[model samples]
Target: MEKVTREEEIDEIEKIRMTLGAHLEELRRRVVYSIIAIVLCFVFCWFFKVQILDIAKKPHRFAMGKAGLSSELQVLSYQEGFYAYMKLCFITSVFIAYPFVIYQIWQFVRAGLYKKEKKYILLFLPISYLAFVVGGVFGYFLLIPFGLQFLIGILGPGIQPIITMQQYVSFVFMLTVALGLVFQLPLVMLLLSKIGIVSPDKFIAWRKYAILVIFIIAAIVTPPDPFTQTMTAVPMIILYELGILIARPTKKGFILLGTAVGCGAIAVVGVYFYFTHRGGEINVSNPYGDIQILYPGDRGWKKVSGHMSFQKGITLKTGKGGRTVLSTKKGVNVGMDTNTEAHFFDSWKMQLKTGQILISMKESEIPLEVDTPNGRIRMNKGTLNIQAKDIVTIVTAVNGEATLLIEGEEKKLLEGRQHKMSIGGEPVDIGAIINWSEGIVTKSDEQK
Candidate 1:
């Protein structure tokens, strides 16, 4: 009996070793397939390297333009361009081949999962890819442009920006990839809950800490500014909420929860739209030089300094070399430039009668409406510089998106772009008047 028992134990150990070996072999084969897919994608991307480079340079160009500098990137060394191209192509290839790689991963792991669990994994594969693409697009369209603009804008006047190709490529690639990976937050949370590693109740209890950690992660991943970090953190918070909603005990429960959330969201949007047409009071402070205020039905403009609150129909005018900052209860800031005159229709809406004003909506998500002689400027978030002249209004989207309504037609004004329209409400092209890349010099040019 002892001899038989010993033989049985040896046979069991051998079978275990054989199973492990087979799994390893399968993993190796999957890895090879993924590598082949990546290689093919790399070759395809390399063929369109120039077009890819152009697409990559758009944000950099916009940033430089906003900074009132040239948009050309430098090549510090001859090999720098080569390496940059290689890195760009490789990153692009990875994004293109990501789905196939995920499919291979699913194939390798499916054998270990039960039939029901395998369905979940398969369903997640495409969704995972979609989330990654959404993250990448968010970074490319909003975060990258605005972050670069803020960083460049802070360098101030007279300091020349010397960005190199290799450095820029590396920065862009790292940021894009990091955002793509981080956007898997909700899916990761759901997975943890499903595997019993974390419960939904635990996630709810840890909400405050999760928020703190989310902001910290945003700071690490984004440019070192409160504006950019907050911009990144807001979406992350929403994703966390989504994770909680999807972490129900059963699929049916999740579906019911999703339906409720969808209805809630629609109601929220309706409420927001209704509030957009309403008005509120605003606080004006930090007056420098000569600042005058005219209240509703006032006989004369009163010259005053210090904090003051104004209701609807109040007008504020600044004299020569005068400036002041306006703030709202919701944390919107608008800086009135020298010799400016603005009339308040509401807390979120103002009319720039003349001169210039700089609006910063970084802390506020509420939309601000500025009515000028030329057109109407509507911005929900970002920094905007508006100069109102006698016959024209010049609006520059310093780091956010705005819409310019000209004669009932709305044209979107994007970051780093300027829109100049005449009093007739016609969109006037000013490409001939403003040289966006003026006064910018490279290191080589500076040396010369």
Candidate 2:
């Protein structure tokens, strides 16, 4: 009996070893194939490095032209350009070989998942690829241009902006890859929700915090400007909300309809605001020195002195030792200090392009919205001091109550509270609001 038991144990051990060996062989084979595919793609992309590089430089050139700066990009080292070219080819190869890599990964893991779960691979692969491509296109077309323009424009004409080939390529690669990963937010959430790891209700409840986090991420990743941060954050917020919609298990049809309608309404509103406000009249008053306005759909800057009504969507840039006051007919007052850049989206919405702006508004049926790099503030009959600097936004509610909306959540600020919000972290209380807004002028009591 003992001999029979020993033989059986030996046979079991042999079977287990064989299975492990087979799995190892399979993994090795898949890895080799993936490597071969990547190498082949790399060689192919290397041949078209010139064309790829040129395509990547388009946004930089466009931004430079818009800023009235030179279109030339420099190379600091002898091997810098060559290394950049290699980096470009490597990234392009990864993109081209992504499908094969995903396939190999799926093959290696397919046996571990249930038969029902395995079927999801077919659905996930193509959608994942499409998401990456969409994100890459967005980064290239919108994010890069807006980021470059804001960063360059903020120099205040004191410095000539010149970028290096290596730096620019590195920036492009990071932005595209980061956005590609970010675009996976919806898919990841759906997967987690399906697995019972996350639920729709939880996401909905966390929406406000999520939006705040998204803006913080945008501020950390992109340039320190409201426009650039907004361009990056809005899409992420939309995707996050969509993820919540997908996570819900009931009323799929209704949810889809509601999402579509909501999206359409937002699109319509955005388009209406963009077209009507684009090049519409704005009143600019310079208290001292000259003010330059970069009009919408125009690359060049227009000089303005004293009171002038220029088109909306124009960025008001104040010269050194210059102070400007801007007001719309709709009762919005903006006081800009020297070297400040501001953009009036409309009477209801305005963005502090750069520097500090003292905003005072009268009590009205509609609340005024001010967008900063950190988040958005909505208020009625309030005085708020908003300042945007590198990676930080300081907001002080001098008087009246104001709501700071981030990630869909609203935090109410009292008259004397000051909030200092940064890109990579939560808002911190930095003492009393009076300390920051003491001498600054605001609307009178009658205005409130």
Candidate 3:
């Protein structure tokens, strides 16, 4: 009997060793597959590395343009650009190969899971990739643009920023990857719940603690600024709430999740329409002395009061000693000076028939086109003063940049500079040009 027991023990030991060896082999195969995917992606990405770099540089360029600075990334050393390009291509490869790599990992691990466990994993595999992509898109579109704008332009103007290629690339890559990983909060919770480790009730009970930890993580992941940290933490808190909702595996939980998702989709659609449509009108405020608007087909100009809106093809006129402001949904602010006459062609284009107009754009992606008798001025993002007379047009770039086209000639106007159409360009005092618009105050400005 003792010999029989010894033989059984030996058999059990040999079976366990064989199982372990098989698992190791599977892991090796998965690793090889992942490496091959990454290598293939890297080679493809390397050929278009310049275009990738340009895409990465877009946010930085936008921030610099908004801040009225040059949009050039500096290189500290000769080899720095080469290494940065390599790193950039590698990061791009990882991003492209992430789904395939996850699939390889999933294949290796699925064999060890029970039927129920495998079902849950399979359900979450695509969802995990989708969440990661959403996180990356959020970082790229919203966070990077606004975060870099705040960070780079927080000091105001007059300070030139010399961001190095290595540092910039590292910052962007780290932030993107961190956000992508952080977005896995809900999946982690679902997995824990499926495994009987933690329940939805526990997640709800620990909400306060989780929020605290989320803020801490946001502070670590984002730049050391309240704006960026708050932006990151808010989304994390929302994800935490979502995790709690998803942790419940009952029918009621699914119904609640569906309702919440439906509401979110409606809200997003509503916001999109609000910005894109905006009733095809520009808002008017800060009517001082006398400000009047003439509709597209109106024969007479009507006096404007506290707040009003003008449709396209309407003409706005300011009497002597009068000033007012026109604002669009796209962040274009047009301040009409005393005795100014301008025609509101549309949301993005205006015709300055005569007098001076002060235009201040706040992070507007759409270009503002102002037509004058002498030339046409096009600016995507800037603060400038335009004076149109009978034969000549004067443009003073108080902040940011502008482009002037006249008589088949195009000129670039930089900040703190003045360009007289048909004449030339020269440096000017921004304060002098923008001082008149200071007196025109809207309710929001008054509250400020």
Give the TM-score comparing model 2 with the true structure, all chains together. 0.54
Tens-place lDDT per residue, model 2, 80-105, is: 98999999999889989998999999
Better of 2 and 3 by lDDT: 3
TM-score of each: 0.53, 0.54, 0.56
**Poorly placed runs, candidate 2 (over 4 Å):** 1-21, 249-448
Q: How does each model score on lDDT?
A: 0.79, 0.77, 0.81
Clashes of each: 0, 6, 0
Off by over 4 Å in 1: 1-18, 249-448
Q: Once model 3 is optimally superposed onto the true structure by TM-score, how far is the C-alpha of residue 447 displaced, in angstroms? A: 89
Question: lDDT score, residue 161, model 2?
Answer: 59
lDDT of 1 by residue, 131-250 (tens): 999999978977787678678766744366789999899988887887888788889888788777899899878889999999999889776788678667877777777788788556
Give the TM-score (vs. native) of candidate 1.
0.53
Candidate 3 per-residue lDDT over residues 327-357, each given as its tens digit: 9777888999999999876677889989999
